[model samples]
Target: MTRLVVLSLCIGMVSAASVMSAASAAGPAPSGTAGMLFNHEHLNNGSPGWNETGVRLNYTLAPRHAFELAVARTERFDLRDRQLSALYVAPLSRELTGSLEANASSTHRVLARNAFGTTLQYEFAPAWLVHGGVKTTRYDTVRVNQALLMLEHYFSNFSWAVAWRPAHAFGTNANSAEVRASYYYGDKNTIGVILAGGKEAANIGNAVTLTDLRSAAVVGRHWLNREWALNYGIGSTRQGDFYVRNGMTLGVQYAF
Candidate 1:
């Protein structure tokens, strides 16, 4: 039953592409040379529940080139997890661009895991962008490989983006996908919906767990002034056989 539900959701995201409209959760950080975002998320999937806190920084070095740094900490039922990642983006030409990312994570169970990846993007037509990427992750003695594809389009009032990722670990294969659509209105208010789910394997405290994770929620953001904004969302997820209900997410952003 879990497998069937996940497959149906994946197909639905793809089919909606033909007729749906724009941007993603809160839309891209307003384009600028420097910016900061603070985020918080709470989720329960019939388990003890978890909360994640994160912050990200972005800097644009030159036209079409940027750098980003992010840090996150997660509170699980019994332990905590931490992660840090960096990304670099550069445009090769007017219609082509590329990005590279490196990540490291640690937890009470899995001492550490490292990942490196790259992505290529192309603007094939006006307001249409396509992207593909590959990533390799290494734990103490396990390696996981992932491949991804995404499509994004911008409309006059909204924007839409979808991504599919397939991963291989422990001699098994799993798939995941994400869908986002956001509409912009008023001076700086934006409303959006997000969905992410799939069946995958995860490493927790040196043990491997096969997880059936799924979540869907509606989110929105309101800009109070030129430098301050607020964001919030509500959602639920299913983790393994447990269900997390009424999950809440919130965030604040500052731009200079």
Candidate 2:
């Protein structure tokens, strides 16, 4: 179903942690900096394929303060949908940071009508961080709410993270967990692997269903120069009693 497709997209993009971790790995960009990114992804489940194209713009207003806007178009099951999203991140303190994100889709037939999320991260010790977040998503026929907690550690050029998420939807509850490990290399370059498994609720043919899912992915970013970078990901997912999906993503970023 569409919920499974959304999960695939999350794996292909490596989730929000990818963005936050990459920023930590590369350190902060100068204030007044701006960047643009273009991304394309393709996914198949042994039948008709799904594709998504997206663009994102990011601007840094000051140290530890930034904003992002993005738009995406997706084609799946012979239907097309468009979504718009925005995010703001700021420092609550020297050791605490917070972010808020909201998104909406033009069509709710296959995507969520709207969603909002907020996260707070704190560094309690050198090279160690903890994050907590909550999100709510409204679909055409159902509303899902989720809470997440994550812990991360950095040493030398390597970083490791683990997260747990609990979700409620359609009067049912489910849980999932994920782990990621990344290595930083060169200037603003990183490579990482992610593994996740869990149960989730999905909308299927007018009925809400709870299903099991598992996914794995490898993602990376490489700087071609001071102003250009390439991002790539490849992954696969298994949706219980449904389908197996394999996908790849490629993107480019430019900064000024």
Candidate 3:
């Protein structure tokens, strides 16, 4: 029973890591030229866990350039994983934009990863867009490569986005697809939902097997004033038969 519990915990961590890895690789930025964000998450399923308070800051220096920095920690059982990342965005043309990002993570007492990626987005119409990017990460002696593609559409008060990502790491392959939709109201308030899932290989000891993953969430944001806002969400995830994870996120943001 103890061994089974440990195995389940590792699988859950892998499931979470896969999603975070893809989402952080190449993503669209939200409106508002600059802001500071504070976020927290509490999860229980495979093993009770919670993410340490996360912080992010974003600023647009000009019409053509922007910068962002973020930090977060995840605690599972008695171990902790910490991550830090930085990103820069610049316009390549009136309809094209490019972004560069760098990230590092440490798990427990050992360095876990160092990664970098570049992404390019093209606006085909006022409301339609496409983007693609490639990322590379080094995990000790192993290297991982990832490719990403996304399509997005925006209306006056609603937006939708979809993405496909495939990656190779540690002698295994993983792929994921994600969809998100949001509707805006009262100029600053919004409600949204997301659905995402994927498959990856998990190697335990000498056995290699495939694991299926699924996750969904509903989120909302409300503004108290012109500068202060609240964000909240609840979600659930399944990692094959290893365990089911359910979680909630709470956040606050200040716009400048």
Among all candidates shown, the one with the greatest TM-score: 2
lDDT digits (tens) for residues 151-235 of candidate 2 = 9888877778898989998788889898878777875677878888898665432455667878898877777988887778788
Q: How would you encode candidate 1's per-residue C-alpha lDDT over 1-256 as one tens digit per residue?
A: 0000011111112221221111111233455423233333344433455556767666655544666677877666546778897877777887777788887886534424778888777778877878788888787777878787889877777777788988898788989888877777776677777788886555433465557767787777677888777766666656566434455666776766
lDDT of 3 at 77: 48
Stretches of candidate 1 exceeding 4 Å from the true structure: 1-47, 106-112, 204-206, 242-246
Question: Per-residue lDDT for 143-170 in model 3, tens only?
Answer: 7677888887767677777878787876
Root-mean-square deviation of Cα positions for candidate 2 versus the true structure, in angstroms: 5.3
For every candidate in turn, the CA RMSD to the true structure comes to: 7.6, 5.3, 9.0
- Stretches of candidate 3 off by over 4 Å are 1-46, 107-112, 140-142, 200-210
Task: Give the range of the ten consecutive residues with the poorest summed lDDT in model 1.
Answer: 1-10
Candidate 3 contains a number of clashing pairs equal to 0
Better of 2 and 3 by TM-score: 2
For each candidate, the alpha-carbon lDDT, in order, equals: 0.61, 0.69, 0.60
A best-first ranking of the candidates according to their lDDT comes to: 2, 1, 3
True-structure lDDT of candidate 1:
0.61
